[model samples]
Target: MTLKQQLTDDMKTAMRGGDKHRLGVIRLVLAAIKQREVDERIELDDAQTLAVLEKMLKQRKDSVSQYEAADRQDLADVERAEMTVIEAYLPAKLDDAELDALIAAAIAETGASGPRDMGKVVAAVKEKAAGRADMAVVSGKIKTRLAG
Candidate 1:
């Protein structure tokens, strides 16, 4: 099933199971997806849906960090809980070794000779990694690789 369809199915399951928190998070995801479609006037493919989920994850991460920094452990815990629910829908994260291999492959594929070619290499890696790896970390690694 498509990601959107999966989300809908899970939403129904959550409702049946009386899991209100999970249901709320799933509704938030669906609403975000719908809002994007309405704003862009195009149906989101699985990749686009993943992008929306990634954005939500990023927001949650930021909230968690900010809450922690302000010593609001209670609020941070809520964001962390939401993150757990959100992350359940995402693909497994890439391990460092796998991520390194992907970076090497992307650099080879893009023929990225140096730091100047960072964008092309990063784009290639990002496409292959999809939402599995963090791009900022990948970009930094690529920069270090190309620099050396």
Candidate 2:
């Protein structure tokens, strides 16, 4: 089944299980996906759906940090909960060694030689990550490799 269908099935399960927290998060995810489809006038494939989930995860991460910095642990906890639910659908995150290998491969594949080639390397790695990478971290690594 498609990712969207999986989300719908999980939503029903959560409802029947009386898991309000999970149900709310799932609804929010579905709403976000629907909004994107309405705005773009196209149905999202699995990759595109994954991209939306990643975007939501990033937003939740940012909110969690900001809430904590503002001394609002309660709010931060809510964001963290939402993040966990959203992350359930994403692929397993890459570890440091794997990420480094992927970056090296991207750089080599792109024939990236210097800082001027940063975009190509980043694009290659981003494609490999399927929009799942923390771009800030990836770009920093790419810059260091190229500039050094």
Candidate 3:
């Protein structure tokens, strides 16, 4: 089944199991997906769905940091929980070794020789790493590699 269908199934399972927290997170994901579809006037494929989940995960991460900075452990915990739920649906993350390999390949493929070519390298990496790696981390790696 598609990722969207999996989310719907998980939502039903959460409801049946009386998992309020999981259910709420699943609903939040579905709502975000729906909102994007409505705004774009098109259906989202698995890649687009993953993008939405990633965006939500990033927002939750930011919230967690802000809450922790304010000494609000309870709020931070909630955001962390939501982040965990969202992460469960994302593609497996690339580890340091795999990420490095991917970055090297992207740089080679794009013939990026210096920082000026960073954008080209990044665009290539983003296409290959989408849903499988964090773009921010990938970008940082690209910068470091290009600079040195």
Q: Which of the numbered candidates is closest to the native, going by highest TM-score?
A: 1
Which 10-residue span in candidate 3 carries the lowest summed lDDT? 125-134
lDDT of 1: 0.95
Candidate 1 TM-score, C-alpha based: 0.98
Candidate 3, residues 96-134, lDDT tens digits: the string is 999999999998998989999999999888888889998
Off by over 4 Å in 2: none
Error of 2 at 36 (Å): 0.3
lDDT of 2 by residue, 55-139 (tens): 9999999899999999999999999999999999998888778888999999899899999999999989988888566878888
lDDT of 2: 0.92
Decoy 2 TM-score against native: 0.95
lDDT (CA) per prediction: 0.95, 0.92, 0.94
Q: Report the Cα lDDT for candidate 3.
A: 0.94
Q: Model 3, residue 47: what's the lDDT?
A: 89
Of the pair 1 and 3, which is ahead by lDDT?
A: 1
The C-alpha RMSD of each candidate to the native structure, in angstroms, is: 0.6, 1.1, 0.9
Ranking by TM-score: 1, 3, 2
**Model 3 segments beyond 4 Å from truth?**
none
